[model samples]
Target chain A: MILRLGADFLVAVLFSLWAGRPGWPGFVIGLAIGFVIVSTSDLAFGRPNHGRRLLWMIHFAGYFLAILIRANLQIAREILTPGFNQTPRIVRYPVQDLDDLQVTVLANCITLTPGTLVVDASEDGRWLYVHCMYAEDRAKAVNGLQKLDDRLRREVFSW
Target chain B: MDTVRDVITVILLGSGLSFMLIGAWGVVRLPDAYHRLHASSKCSTLGLFGMLAGAVVYIGTVDALIKAALTLLFTVVATPVGSHILAKAAHSRGLRQWDHTLSDELADDQRDGPPQV
Candidate 1:
């Protein structure tokens, strides 16, 4: 809850600064408004484990950028070349122990990465169906997803 | 230092535009909805990041820099969720893949009545 409030305060201050009023008074006002909204929302939806998530956010930002750059370059190369060698396939990724939020985060990470799109999650949220543009080596792709899931579970959920 | 910043800004802007163009090309050329989402989401997110970085360099104000950073963060977090939803919706609607699709584990799961996960 405290971390969420801090994040909200940061956003509010940034917004105020972006609005061309970068002063302490504006920032204080923004912080107050942010606190109210964040507190109420936290009340409605159970408070997030924000400290772990904040740490994960920092770690994931760097990791995400590295992957994003590589994926962008790969897709750009594929697009520029002729006769793309994509072997698209859908793979079922098991999500046995993680809760819904973890599964959702894992799924989003999969979609954000190039060459993979999370097509669906089972109603029970125990499985994520991911479509891979390069699926010639299915086991390798699933292994990659597994590694990402493990990292997220470790860093974000500490599970 | 100013000249260096200008050069960096140009490079970032050019790369960002190039990624966006590539994403547009992929949208047109990709064979299926899911494939298009794969291309569009990654490319656009990276493109926006690049462009925003360029803007931050060019503006060189604390406020502008903070805003750009926020935009990039939000984009990184939000784009995947947007793509995930679109892909899920397309799949649930029974959107067909390209004729050459190599595997369909989800379809198989439907037939087999959900595997023991």
Candidate 2:
């Protein structure tokens, strides 16, 4: 709670600076407003995991950005090249261990990556139906997605 | 300093534009909805990220940076959700895959009983 308040204070100062009103008065005013807004919203939303969410956001930004760049390049190359070296496939990825939110996050992460799309999830939420643009080696593609899942499990959703 | 900023902006904006064009081409040229979604989602997201970076650098204002950050955040969150729903709808609507598609593991799973998770 104290840490969350500290972060709110810092963000308030940043906002003050961004608004071209950087000063003690501005900082104090921003701090009060930021605190009230952030606290009220956080309470209203019933989010007890603010710290983890922030960590996930930071990690996700860096990790997703790196992969996004690579995906762009890879897809561009495939698009520009002549012969059809790509094989499209839809694979059902198992995800029963994860809760609903985790499963949803995992599905979205797969969709966000290049060359893959989440077609559907099983009724029980145990299987993620994913379509891949390049599936030359089926095991390799599944393994790649599994790797992403492990990362999300270990890094972002770690308790 | 201004010249350096201009150089950075050009580099970022050029790549962003290239990705956007690639995405558009993929949408038109790709065989099916799923394939096109791959190109559209990935390329457009990265392209937007690049363009936002360029804008933040060129403008060089704290206000601009904050706005850019918010836009980037929204893009990151929204794109995947949008694509997921579209892909789900396409599949449910019985959209045909490209003729060359080698496997339908999901269908096979549905037939054979889903793998135990």
Q: Which lDDT tens digits does candidate 2 get at residues A13-85?
A: 7778787786556667787777777767788988665556666767876997787788888889888887666
Residues B29-102 of candidate 2: C-alpha lDDT, one tens digit per residue: 87788878988888888899889999988987656876798898798778888888898787777788888998
DockQ of each: 0.59, 0.62
Q: What proportion of the true contacts does each candidate reproduce?
A: 0.81, 0.74
Q: Any runs in candidate 2 off by more than 4 Å, and if so which?
A: A1-60, B111-113
TM-score for all models, in order of appearance = 0.80, 0.81
Predicted model with the maximum DockQ: 2
User: What TM-score results for chain B in every one of the models?
Assistant: 0.94, 0.94
Clash statistics: count for each candidate: 0, 0
**Candidate 1 lDDT over residue span B1-117, tens digit each:** 999999999999999999999999999987778778888999999899889989988987657876897898788779888888887777778998898899999989877868773
Clashing residue pairs found in predicted model 2: none
lDDT of predicted model 2: 0.82
Stretch of 10 with least lDDT, candidate 1 chain B: B60-69
